[model samples]
Target: MPLLWKTSILLAISHDSNILPAHLQPLPSRGGHIRWNWIGDEHLNKTTDIIYMNASVAADGTLTGVSDFRATKFNGVTWLKTHAGREGVFAFKGPKAFMSIPGIVLPQDLKTFTFEASYAPQGAQNAELIRSGDFRIAWKGDTLSIQNGANTYQGSIPAVPAGQWVQLGCVVKEGIPSLFVNGKAVALLPGQSQPLTSIGNATLIGSGYTGMMDELRVWKEARPATRLGRDISPTWADRLLYFHLPADTKRSMGEDKASWASQIAWIRSRLRNPADHMVRLGIAGGAWKDMLRDPKARQKFAGEIASIVNRYKLDGVDLDFEWIEGPYKGDPPARQWDNYADLAQRIRKAQPDMCFTISLHVVCYRMPKKGIDAVDYFTFQNYGPSSARYPFDDFTRSLAAFRKQGFPDSKIMLSVPFQGTGDAKADSVRLYSDIVAQHPNLPPTADTAEFTYPDGTKRKMTFNGPATIRKKCEYAKAQKLRGIMYWDMGGDVRTDARKGQTDYRHPKALLPVINEILKGRR
Candidate 1:
């Protein structure tokens, strides 16, 4: 699993080939992985410098595939329990595990080429996961698509979620091939107009893989998704909190008991605050336009959010639909986005370990994508009206255009606005604690803030303070993304610097760098 970094163009071997390169040799696994096949697999010469490696050793040690490669044991692949400390391994029970790489060639000039990796699957078929000759890459069912001769790309592919650890990709020359989950490009598929001529002979990896896989590069050029490596979701590494509370847009919410004792004193001060990974605390509701297009109002809005989580024992709810992506305004288009994925599959059949989420919009439009993959997390509200500056390439090209439209930056998330949409021409949302309670010098550099209105018109405001929310939570924990959402907790309003305000608190400046880059994920 070696590739901590290195890819301006290429470099390979080491997702546990343990750095093989003396000519090559290492492949053996009946319970792990090793299907080998690259003996004369020509087609890797844009100034050739290949270093391929795919290791796995078990059935009684001593590597295996060495020359003109071709080994197989396939007990339906295995391995994947190591964490943070870094032991690069991943295999899946794919339809009887497979692999082959011989004569792999393709660059019949389709324009730009690319196909990075870090995948995770386990459902929906029309499988293949990877192939060479006809240049395939499957999952036609739950979506992660691509094909060659006579093309195959259905568009949006973000829900083939069997075990959920996406980072899959594709970038075939440009116009048509798009899908890329975790590193985020999300979906596009649709345009081939014909061009990619010579592609495979061999180069397959689990013809029907069910789950797990790691760092499988193959970039002829469009490369630029990077940020592989993920593993930390033991309920978000033990209690990654969520206090969203938006609902008060008027009624049917928490049906009252003084709003259920102020949401049980805001989930008991967010699990007794001072955050040592605050073990669970969700609520994020509002976006309730009569609970989207109706099926008995989405079964009475999932039975009033399952009776407010069995009447106040509440520990999770976040549906925040943010416009289920229908025809918008009062939504209705044939079941306003399939009745919110059938009300999150009946609220995951009534809270199967609740902690649901959904709040995307990086141009999602019609974005239901399997109803936010049936929940457990989803976010992307990537802010706006930042006067003029929020362009970190417009937030990484709207996260590579939401992974080209498939959406699965590992459960996805990136939202960014600690309040202050204010006067980017009267868009007005203001809440860097009321823009520092009337501009008392304000300038922690949210695109160089500014204020002067009352009609004197002199605006320019953004917001994110506290070192731009610790540099966007360290670029969403170095882009493995999946958690960093905060859209309106009253706009980061901790407020206390002697009332001159500006603390934008939200759990003391965003949970100490989101609990130090997610409890320090190795």
Candidate 2:
């Protein structure tokens, strides 16, 4: 038997005076046999009309309906129903419907089910109107089949059609369930199955009935047909949980050289306890300059990073070096690139087991390919004016360009910005909260930068929200790309040159969302 989540009842009817009675009961605590009363009013009398009751149950049980006046008792250990009212009352009515409990003979377990009962259309009207317009059924797995009125049908999974009253049944036998329409086989499942147990709920019935259901039975047996009724896919929530880092930890450091060190500490703290998904520590841009300036400084930085690995520990290190001043600057000042390469090579040598990353700008025309090849992962900073205009195409082309330079997809990282900027003056150089407090004209979207082209045309660039980021991540995954990294972590903070004070705003805002996307859970 498979684990069951929850059971529900759906009733659709048109008549005004129709009353559907419901009886609620408790599920049995221990595994054992149980019994219940299956009684209903016998006043039902209508021609060419179908009537039935629907109930939710857990565990396997029998429902025996006894006609008191007629002294006729129909006992069904599986699933049962009728087309008209009772046998002989309506000759034009369809069959005396009784469906068997889907056999439970498979080897695996089942998870979900959908069932429905419906009324099939008659003649040209039936063909044009859509067959099985009204039907009712319940399932423990994917699909169900049922019959009602003058028509029979392959019922819809999860929901039956309106206007027809048909009893639908679904059961999980081992790992499969079979669906039957009007006692005839309709669908089968070789793998999917859901355990059928008792759900303490009343059975639904008649006229107002979207579709009639009565003498509905649930058993430990499997119904193969139900698995064909619907599709089952895993949800984002189902992937499991992973923590990136604390808000304060991610925010406390700014775009300064020390932010990388702080971030390393933060990542170590997060990795103290392992989770299902992997955790990453990103050292923002500008930090590389601090590491390269002095030999003593370089050693200290490396030592601290190694301590981070030894202490809280980490999966990898992300290199975000925005120090390259652009192509027009010519040759990139030589020593800067050398120092950058040295830092990367050292990190790789020290932590060969870790993922060594370097954040490089996306100017393929000007970027030094040799410097990029030193790191385990090279994240291209796809922000600024060049990226805003041709976002997707430009990024794809740039990735291709990197591959042409001998950089594999697994070695590349896509760095997108979460903050936006427009006018240098209007842009909040500080935290968002501080920006809000100081600059009254600044809008939530104003912080994003807007770039101006050589032709004097301007385009606005905003940080992508979770949805867009998720799509981008998916695209990257599909391309077999390495991973994603972002620009300066503290770009949202407000800085005051006069007082020399800084405030990190929205530090926790985007990191979690990014982590979620990377883990394929967003």
Each candidate structure's TM-score, on Cα atoms with residue i matched to residue i, is: 0.28, 0.35
For candidate 2, the 10 contiguous residues with the lowest summed lDDT are 4-13
Scored by Cα lDDT, where does model 2 land? 0.33
- TM-score, model 1 to reference: 0.28
Error of 2 at 240 (Å): 37
Which digits, one per residue and each the tens of the lDDT, describe model 2 over residues 1-522?
Answer: 110000000000011112111111111100000011111111111000111111111111111110111101222211222334421111111122221112121111223232322332111111110111222333322333232222233434433343333434444333234465544554642332223233222112221212223322222234345332222112111111010111112232111111223322322233223232132343442234444655555555555555555554455544434645543224444566665566566666666686455546666322345555656555565655432522566667777777776677766666545444442332322222223333445443343444443346565544444445456555665676665544323222333312222232233233334444444321
Alpha-carbon local distance difference test for all models:
0.44, 0.33
Question: By summed lDDT, which 10 consecutive residues of candidate 1 come out lowest?
Answer: 5-14
Q: Report residue 467 deviation for candidate 1 (angstroms).
A: 19
Expressed as tens digits, the lDDT of each residue in 271-298 for candidate 1 is 2222211112222333344545445655
